[model samples]
Target: MKPITMLALACLALSGCKNEEPAASVPSVELRGRLEVDQEKTSARQAQGIEGEYFRRVLTVDGSDMTLDAFINHYCPADTRDETCQKALRIKKIDDVSGATRFLPQGL
Candidate 1:
């Protein structure tokens, strides 16, 4: 065996035996409640014939409450040409909206 090959094998063996510390755990964000849009503002924009509806919603993350603007695509459905058929075809929520607490994080 070559002297360089022996030295490389020895270095590799020593590196494998070295102790490695465990990685630090990352803090996770606990989103416990549903975030909803402000209906009053959304309706106001819809009344003004805005194709892209921009609205604000309040979300509390990591004990801090902040307002965020979200946009939704509003247009007449392809199957219908009526103006009243125009709507924002986004699935806003999946779960029940009633009887849910707001802005409360888990574990107090």
Candidate 2:
């Protein structure tokens, strides 16, 4: 039996199997909250393996509890309302929320 012939037959036998059920999806809920920023992203940590800066926030959406993480190129520890601070975060908001940042409560 030739290798090419055997391979063709194997593929033919496997093609009949089909998934009967649709993929399950998670329900999404509207959430709003404050950010618990971890101020540990010094120059040394980033080089080691830490990914940018990370923040942890607990949000209960529709009765379920969960934690979320956020990263940034720069975070303004100063007043988030400061024009200078918001200007810094502009890059992140435009680029899928992965750049300059300042953690602020929901209302500003």
Candidate 3:
């Protein structure tokens, strides 16, 4: 057998014996924020003939304004429209939220 071939086989064997242990899973943080209706945007949507409620949730995190929608998209899987629904987040909790609780907006 060639030296290069032997070296390659030895390296492969060593890699196989390396740690197979699973990495520790980090807990997700769930944030709680005020679910307020954005009437101005809603009105704009109506003017444009779009039907539906327009919402912008504001949450203060570490003394900064954070968009709840942004966090949800980052933490949850999106649908075809590139949007994450409440049901999806409820089904699967991911990423760091404040209270580790699922966010659900009423009548949305």
TM-score of 2: 0.26
Give per-model TM-scores: 0.23, 0.26, 0.34
lDDT of the candidates, in the order given: 0.40, 0.44, 0.52
What global local distance difference test value does model 1 have?
0.40
Best by TM-score: 3
Assess candidate 2 and give its lDDT: 0.44
Q: Model 1: which residue pairs collide?
A: none
lDDT of 3: 0.52
Give model 3's clash tally: 6
C-alpha lDDT of residue 44 in model 2 = 47
Show where candidate 1 strays beyond 4 Å.
30-108
Model 2 stretches with alpha carbons more than 4 Å out: 1-16, 39-54, 69-108
Better of 2 and 3 by TM-score: 3
Each model's total of backbone clashes: 0, 0, 6
- The sequence of per-residue lDDT tens digits that candidate 3 reaches over residues 76-101 is 44442322345335422432232223
Per-residue lDDT of 1-108 in model 1, one digit per residue for the tens?
A: 699999999999998997976533222323232455557655776798755434334435457664321211122224644322222112223112321234333332
Worst 10 residues of 2 by lDDT: 67-76
